[model samples]
Structures are given as structure tokens and as C-alpha cells.
Target chain A: MSVTGAGRPRLATKKRPGDTAREEILDASAELFTTRGYTNTSTRMIADAVGLRQASLYHHFSNKDDILDSLLSGTVDEPLAVGQGIQGVEESAVVKMYAMAWFDADQLSRSRWNLGALYLLPELRTDRFGSFRESRFTLMNLYATIAGGVVQELESDVSAGTEELPFRLVETIVNGRADTENGRGSAGLHHASLIATAAVRVLGFPGDIDGIHDRAVRVVADVTASSIFEKKAGHGQ
Target chain B: MSVTGAGRPRLATKKRPGDTAREEILDASAELFTTRGYTNTSTRMIADAVGLRQASLYHHFSNKDDILDSLLSGTVDEPLAVGQGIQGVEESAVVKMYAMAWFDADQLSRSRWNLGALYLLPELRTDRFGSFRESRFTLMNLYATIAGGVVQELESDVSAGTEELPFRLVETIVNGRADTENGRGSAGLHHASLIATAAVRVLGFPGDIDGIHDRAVRVVADVTASSIFEKKAGHGQ
Candidate 1:
């Protein structure tokens, strides 16, 4: 009765960061899953981390797979919706490309845990994670779509299918953060705009993208302040 | 004694590719670790896949960690040596960048299994894989050095740390292959030169890369034929 949920009383007081019990579980799971290997971390361990009994943990997540699925989906769903929402925005492809890169890379970098690191978990290769993979692929396609426009606008000779490079360039921040966190490389290798610039540059953006940069920054600020997530906040995830 | 190594009899006939038992073990481990999940795979599973007794597997590798380490190191060691050897090659940074990207990405694509998938293993973040992480960092720095040369040659205004993007762009092929194999994307998304072009282009190569592409192809052909591995062969692995 002390806690917000219908679950039994917590064995310990609130300690994790999130506002709700499910979010608390996710926050704890994210830390444990990324630090301890996914296969190494168990459902019981996750429950214990969040100060909840095993039964209460199941009330939120059916199993470890569900917890991981929710964690992975959290990283992508916003970007996927945001990327899709902006498809019809009246900005040029260059600005759109910059906006998406800035937003997505920033999300990957700013997340409390580097859940992006889990994108390659071998467990994800299974059918259980197929939806996550598809959402990711859809995000890549959105990047490619915007990047294809940049390719056309620039008239660059970049090979076909190279459009995916922009998205891939953005995703490199995942590794950049991982390596830097491990103390293996220089710091700030994954700065948001730096990666955004490089993501656009990968399309042969040529020298002096200052104009595109300013416009895209404005676009990012404008669209994100009023993105679809806000428009449909209470419609249900 | 029918087999080459000093171990017990085999459990199955030769089925894996490799010139030696060590190579065969690596091949088997690469496939299993990338698919079955690294933490889930036991030494016995690898031995069974390779048709060796668990004792024979131990004779070649101290444990599962050692096998995983050897598999990962195999993917990076050749690139590091060749990349370092060519640091002084009489070629433009553009050509060197092209050659390195082409060679490294091709190695990733051409590998029988997507061992590059293991590069992000959380277990690799541990001290046990410190040497492998260091070698990979060395390789990235080599790419950055060559990429830095390209930036200077072009007088690019890229951010100070952006030299790393060229290397990271080449690595996208790892994800590209994993995605394609999962039937999530097109087949040739990981093609070597397509990605190499995108990698070099990230350095602001601009249009008309045909000349640089041709020269780099020649560099790749020349250097790989007489590289250090051949010169140091039989000097002891």
C-alpha cells in the first residue's frame, strides 16, 4: 500500500531515478543489462535491483525478454516517430537530414545508459527482437530518404545505397560513447552536432556547410519543441 | 594422432573451413558466438560444432573467453598490421584512406561469419579483452591519422575530433551485414567499395572520385600482395 502500484510493498525504499515503478525497473535494468552482460543479468536480479519482489516485476514485464524489448524499443520509437513525422515538413532535405542526425545521435548520447550498445546483442538477432530490428530498419530508411534528397540536391557521385551511410555515420556515436566510456579513446568523440555534421558530410556535402548548419539547427529546435510525441502524448504508447 | 594437433580423437569429421585446427576452432566459434549468443555458448558447444573433444578444445584454447578473444583478434590483427605497415607508403592520404577502407571493410564483408558483431560485446569491455580493444583503438587511430592527412590535404574545416568518422563510417558495414543477414535490408548494402566511397567522402572528398578510386585500387592490389604477413610468415604467429 505504500508504493504507487498494485504490487506488494517494496523490500527497500525508493532508490532508482524514474518517476514510476515501471520506469524505475527500466532504469535499473538498463544499467544492469549494459554493465553486466544481458545473458548474465537475470529477472530476479532486475527485481532485486529495483527493490521489488519477483511477482511485481512480472506485473510490468512478462520476462527478461520483455524488459529488454521495452528498453531497446524506447531508444528507437521516438526517433522512428519523429523521423516519420518530419517526412512532410517543408524544410530542404539537407536541413531535415541534419535535424534527424542531431536528434537521434543526441538521444543515443544523452541516454543515462548506453542502451545503444545493446543493439548488437546476439539475443536481438532472434525472432523475439524482430520488431526492434524492423523499427531500426525503418529509421534507417527514413535517414536514407532524407539523405537521398541530399544526394540528389548535391548531385554528388556517391554510389547508390550509400544513402544509408548517413544513418550509419550517426550510429557510430554508439561505439564512440562505448569506447570513450571504457577509457580507451579521447573524450567528446561522440558530440551530437559533430556527428550530425559528419553524417551530412558523408553524402559529399562538400566544403562550407555553414548555411545548411544554421538552417538545420533552427529546424531541429522548431520541430522538436512541438514534435508529434507531444501532440499524441495521452493517446497511448 | 591421425589429426594434426596433440589431443584426443575427433567427435566428427572435418566440416569447418581453415588450414589448421586453430583456424577451424575460430571459424566455428565465430559462427556460434554471433548467432547463439556469446554468453550462451559453452566450450563444449564449440567443440561439438568443430568435431573436437572438449579436452582437445582446451588444448587449443584455455577456455571460452580465450576462444572468443582469439576469434575477435583474428578480425582486427591483420588490418592493424597492414594499416601500420602502409603508414609510410608513397601514396596520397586520399589513396591510403581509400585503400585502408577498401581492405578493412572487405575483410569484414568477406569473413565467413560476421565476427565484427562481437566487437561490441560487453564482455570485451572487461580487462580480459584489453589487448584486443587496444589493437582496435590502434587501428582506428591509423584510420584517423590517414583521415587527418586527408583533412589537411583538403583544408577541411571539420571539427577537431571528426577525423574518427571516416573509420567509423567503414565500420557501418558490420551492422550492414548483420542487418542484411537478418533479411532486414538489401543484399549488397555492405559492398566494400560502396562503403569505402562513403567513408572517404565523409572527409569532404566532394565529387569526381574516380581518379582517387583507381589509384587506391592499385595500392590495395600492390600492398596486399607483398604485405608484412607474407614477409613475417613462419616467423611464428
Candidate 2:
């Protein structure tokens, strides 16, 4: 790609691991943005980190907003697709819910940078990120629908409040990850599993959770092996 | 009290509703920080918004961070004290959980500005806000304690995942409030009540929720009436 200036002369500095120069810039941006704060990270710093010229970086992305949008989109799209796939499957609501939360939480927990922490950026409330917000809204709706099914199976008014809690519950992984990253606390490696079970539990799913967890694990693995999750090594490589 | 610059001549501009000049500055800062963003807002803009000279503004706060720290502290203290008070009272785990959440959600919901939205400000990661972060940490621990009690009352493995979730669930009001403010989706006026109920339900509280709600409502009102919450009428008033 011309943006990467592939087959061009080398800048010859410390290079980051990425299949392409664009990916390298994204990887650098992710580290700097999350660690240094998004408002504080600059395009020049990203270029320096990736050993690319600023002109070369601009060719791939128009501005810092583009890089942020691309990184944020990569985080949401796979989970939305995986959740949608789990929805049509001939599985119980518990499995569908658990699978969705588990897969979503796993990806958020495993992302190279805790980009999920950026969801609350005041900048995101603007029209520029309408699509990201909508995708997230769709994801929330999917969670509510699956949670609604779980509530129906119980035939009780357990989670009679907002069905949005399941989605909200899974997102705590974002906060937990941020806390751990900040050295405030350690949310053990099992946080994804813990948060997944808690997501359904908040919906009052009072059945064999271990069974649901087992099935969900398989569901997540199937989706991960599919072409969807393997969509590149992903943004931050 | 000197922060108010008492007996000083008034400036002719738009005035915010506050009993004191210090509170007025905080009120304006909360609005600017949450809406325009902490990083983007300058003290000069805040001074202009509140009709104060930049030099006079410095008398009350050293910098933007000082104003931010004061605004952030106001939101956390009342909830922490109320939760602590609830712990000492003879109440069921459900009652305690619901009451703590309802009171917290109410304040977070009713705040003049969505200051809770600023919690994720990347600037907060610094050690300069350590006391504020420590206070928040204490409040979270209190939530976990109340949530743990609810988990124990069930005597089931429902919320074995994380006691931290009940606090996390209540905090979603922050995100929900932001969403509603942005005109994305209306979370409803009853979001505080709904989220408080869900916060407990997440811990598997399965009996007589209406009764718990009734008691919790009364408890929250008592705390609101107390001199503790009435302390200075809060910042961003």
C-alpha cells in the first residue's frame, strides 16, 4: 500500500511487529493512546514509535480520529458478528447469552491495549462516531434480547428492570482491565470467565452455570476459529 | 470562605446558581469538564463562563486539576457516608444493597452536571488525584461488602464471580445518563429505581423485591435528609 510506502527506502529505527506499515502505526497508537491518554497522544509520536514518516502515516489514516475509529471498530465488529451468529443457532438462551458475553469479554480482556476504556471519551458523543455508537447499541440490543429469553424461561419477574444490564455487566471488563493496567488492582486471568457467568447471573439465570459455561466455551472457540475473529492478527497486532 | 472573595464587587455577566463563589466556579467547571472535556477546557473559559477574572479564579483553585479534584470529590463522599451508615443499621442484605445503590444512583442521576461521566478521564490516572481515587476505591469496597452479604444470604453460587459488580452496575447509570444526555436513547426517569433493583438481583436476591424496594426507598430518603448530604449543598449545585 502507498500508505505503508511498501518497497520504499527505510526510515531505519526501532520497528514494531505488524504485517504492514499501517498496522504498525495502529499498534504504536494503541500503546501510546491507552498509556499516555488519547487526548495526549499525537500523530508525530505514533510515527516515531513505528519508525514511519508522518507523511507515510497520514496516507493510511487521515488523522488521529481515523486511527481511533478504526481501532474502536475492530473491537466491536467481531463481537457483534459472533453474538449474531450465536443468536440463530439452535441453542438454549443460557448458552447463547453465556457465549455472547464470554466471547465479547474475552476479546475485550485480551486486546493488546485496553481500548475499551476509551468508550467513555467525551469526544465519542459527537456525530463523527455515530456508527461506533450504533454498533454498540446493536450489541446492547442483542444482549437484551438474549437476556429477555433467559428471563422468559424462568417465567418470573427476576430481571424486570432494564435488560441492558447483561451488556453493562460484560463491559465492566473494560473497567477491570483499566484498573489492572493502572496498577490499582489485579483482575485475575479468569476475569473473562468470571464476568461472563456474572453477566447471565445478573439476568437471574438459575440453572447449571457450569454446563452453560462449557457450551459457551465451545461456541466461542468455533467462532474464533471461523474467519470472523481471525480478521487479521487484528488492529494492535 | 475567602475562595468566595466575600464582599467583593460583582461582575456583570451570566451567574450560575450557587450560594458561594467557590461553588459557582465548581458548577461551571463541572459543566465544562463533562461537556467540552477536561483536556479541552481552559481556566480562562471557566472564569469567563462564571464572570470571574482569571486572576480571581486562581484564588479558589490553583489549576484546572484542583477544580476537577474538588468536583470529583463531592460526588463520592455522600454515597460513601450513606453506604457506611447503612452498614451499621439493622437491615437485610437486600435492603442494604438496594438502599446504597438507590441513594448513589439518585445523586449520580440528579447531579446538576454529569460529573460521573468524567470518571474515565485519562487525566485521573495520575497520582495527583490519589486521594480522590482512594476515596472512590473505598466506596467500591463498600459496595463489594454489601454485595458479598447479598451473595451470602442466597447461600447459592449465584454471584460468586465478583462482588464488585453491584457497584459496577450502579455506575452504569453514568454511561446511561451520558447516553440519555447525548439524545442517543432515553434511559427513563425510573432508571435509578430500575438499576438499584437489578444491582441486587444480580446477586440472586429472589424474594419479595417490592418489600425490599419500599424499605430501601425510605432509607435513601433519610440519608438525603441528613446533615451529611446537606453538607454545603454540594459542588456544581
Candidate 3:
């Protein structure tokens, strides 16, 4: 709601001379895209928000599609990279899954996440977003892989329901919050841990639920708070 | 995408004299509302799509808001009514939850559910849809009520995690499909069963997963296909 930058004229002011139009446009567009959805947001509105005339806005990008392309790459591509990073780690699959969910949640809590939610809108599913869709499914597949490991370790049969259930459970928990105005702030991390716990439970992990809950919370916090999940996970703290 | 009804212009020709203008208008609006979103969809475009001049469309609806209000009551109000009907039933809370998830999924699978999905659009979440929002939360609270019953029946300590997990889990599965152009058709019922199974599992239900899944499928089909989950379930089913 505070994103409109009210009363700030589109003219280049002397005091804020360092701000580039591209960055300003991106910032303004992100706010509108998250708060008002991609389709409802007009280029003129974005220009008006950033204090630029609609014609001047064309200097930076050809049209709205160009702006959306930039936003998609900027916001969505990183998490896919993070998912890929987690995939190459030497840690156990359960730990990798925890790290993925944890970091993914933290990244989603950031302001850029509003742009990511745009991927969910029906109108935005054009070929222009094909890579975003691919990356998203890749990320989901990573969760399924980690979850499948847990099912194997537990010796449970991979029934039709159980195969996709854990991934969907994790997705529901994470994506459910994507639409809220401001992300959960401090509670986002807690929700991430809770999602991890529920996800493991859905996989039929048989440890003590409370103990797993406590350990899972700490594991996600530690993993997301550090770069260890990306490199080799270092233990012995 | 067939929702556009591209070549099928609105006409009162002898061949289609039975089709009412109101129904055609609603159908066209629902298609545009779901695909292009409410804000992006204009009355002019809607009129054109329905083969009416922009001015003539006003005879049926004063504005887009009136059209949206009718769409809400037509498509979304039924689910709310179904939820209310379920609330008055005498079946077990767990059973009610399954029945709710099942019928809700079935209703969502109907083509009209696309209009229901438009409620998720940020632009559409205005004062006009306040009743829709209230009805939505009331339906969610029904799920919460049922989940709470499972928690109490099992005497498990209710933590923050389990409190809303079941409702969200069911929502993730059901609402997740709302964006699909065609409801899963025959596969939709299977997905509904899977959603019911997962929702109950989230509540820590101890029954056989497959058995519960089968029963949930049958219960939902019966409730949705017939009116049994209401009047008949008012006794004991």
C-alpha cells in the first residue's frame, strides 16, 4: 500500500538524482504487479507511479512485455538457481529438502516475491514466461525428489496419492502466503519450518513429531541463514 | 481457451431462440473474467464478445459490478450454501470435512468455477466482493471446525502447525486447479478424492488412507451427484 510513492512527481528531482529510470520503473512496476496483479496494471500507471511520462517510459523498454520479462528473470530465476544449488549438495535428501523450503520461503518473504506471484496469474502464462514455468516445475521436482528419498528410507510404497501429495503439501504451505500484502515478516521463517515439518510428516517420516518439529525448525533456520546449504553442508557446530 | 466462444456470436436467430441473452451475457463475462481478469476485461469487450452493442448490454446490467455480483451469486453462492447445509448435518466431523472437500472440488470442477477463481484476483478483491469474502471465510471456518473436531477426538495437542494446516491443505489442492482452463473432467473426481485423503491426513487421522480415500470419493460423488449428504446425512449416513 505504501508503494505508490504518493506526491512524488515524475520529474527528475535534484536531491534524488542517483535514481535511474530503469530501476525506478522496475520498483514501481513490482509494487503494482504485486498489489494490483499484472493484467490490471497499465504501462501508463507504472510510468505515473515512477514520475515518468508514458512516452518517456518507452526509452527503457519497448512495452509492458519487456518489463514483465525483466521482472520474471530478476525475481524468479534466482530461486531456480537456489534449487539447482541445493540439488548438487552432498547432504542427505531430507536436509536438502529442508534447505530448499527454508531458503525458498525466505526468498519469497522478500519484496521481490510479489513479482514471483505474478507467475500464478492465468493471463501471464504466455510463452514469454515459459522459462519461469520450467524453473518452477524444476523447483517442485526437487522437492519431490527429496520427498521420494524420505519415502524410500521409510520403506513406504509410492502410491498414486502419496507421490505428489508431499510436494503439493509443501507448495500449498508456501504458495498460500504468496498473495498476502506484505509477507509474514519474522513469522515467515516459522511458517517455513512448520511447512517443512508437515511435508516430512506427509512423507510418513516416523520420528518423534515434537523432536522432528524442533530439529526441523533449527535445521531450516541454520540452513537458510548461512551459505552452507549451497556449498558442502558443514556440521559440528 | 474454448471459453472465448470465438465464432459463436450472440444471436436470437430461430435456431437459438431458446438461449436467453442474460445467460449468454453471463457466460461471456465469466470467460473474460477468468481469462483476462475482471479489471483487464472491459464492458465493451464483453458486449462485443456477446454480440451486443456496449449500450445494449446495459439493459441487463447497469455496469460491470452488477455483472460481477450476479456471477458471484450464481457461481460462488452455491458452495457457501453447500457449506451451510453440511454444517447442519449429523455425520461425524471427519466425514463432514471429507464431504465438504469432495463437493467443493466438484463444484470447482464445473465450468462456472472459473468465475469463482476470479475472486483471487487482487483487483477484484474490492468492497463489491465483501460478501463473497465473508462467505469464503465462513466456508474455511467450516473446514477449521471439522479439523478441530479431529484434533479433539484424537486428544492430540493442537499446535500452531495443525490448526490451519488441514484447511490450507484442502485449499491448496482444490484452488490449485481453479486456474486450469478445463476442469479435469473425469480426472477431477480423482483429484478431489486425493485432496480429501490428504486433508484428513493433515489432521492426523488414523484410519486406513486408502479406505478413507475410497470413502471420501464415494461420499463426495454421492453428495454432489445427489443431495444425500444434506437431508439424508441430517440423520446418520
Q: Clashes in model 1: which pairs?
A: none
Among the candidates, what TM-score does chain A have in each? 0.92, 0.89, 0.69
Which parts of model 3 are misplaced by more than 4 Å? A1-23, A52-60, A110-113, A170-190, A209-237, B1-10, B13-20, B51-56, B73-75, B173-190, B214-237
- What would the TM-scores of all predictions be? 0.94, 0.91, 0.76
Tens digits of lDDT, candidate 3, B16-74: 11155666677788778777777778999887777766766787788998888777665
Poorest stretch of ten by lDDT in candidate 1 chain B = B228-237
Give the best candidate by TM-score. 1
DockQ of every candidate = 0.69, 0.47, 0.35
Model 2 spans with C-alpha error above 4 angstroms = A1-8, A158-161, A186-190, A227-237, B1-8, B158-161, B188-190, B226-237
Residue lDDT tens for model 1, A1-237: 234376777789887877678888898999999888899999899989989999998888889999899888888788876776566679877788888988888888888898888887778878899898888888888888899998898886777777877788778888888888777647555678888887777776765667877887777666666746557322112
Interface RMSD values for the candidates, listed in order?
A: 1.6, 2.8, 3.9
Worst 10 residues of 3 chain B by lDDT: B1-10
Count of clashing residue pairs in every prediction:
0, 0, 1
Provide the lDDT at B196 for model 1: 74
C-alpha lDDT of residue A38 in model 2? 82
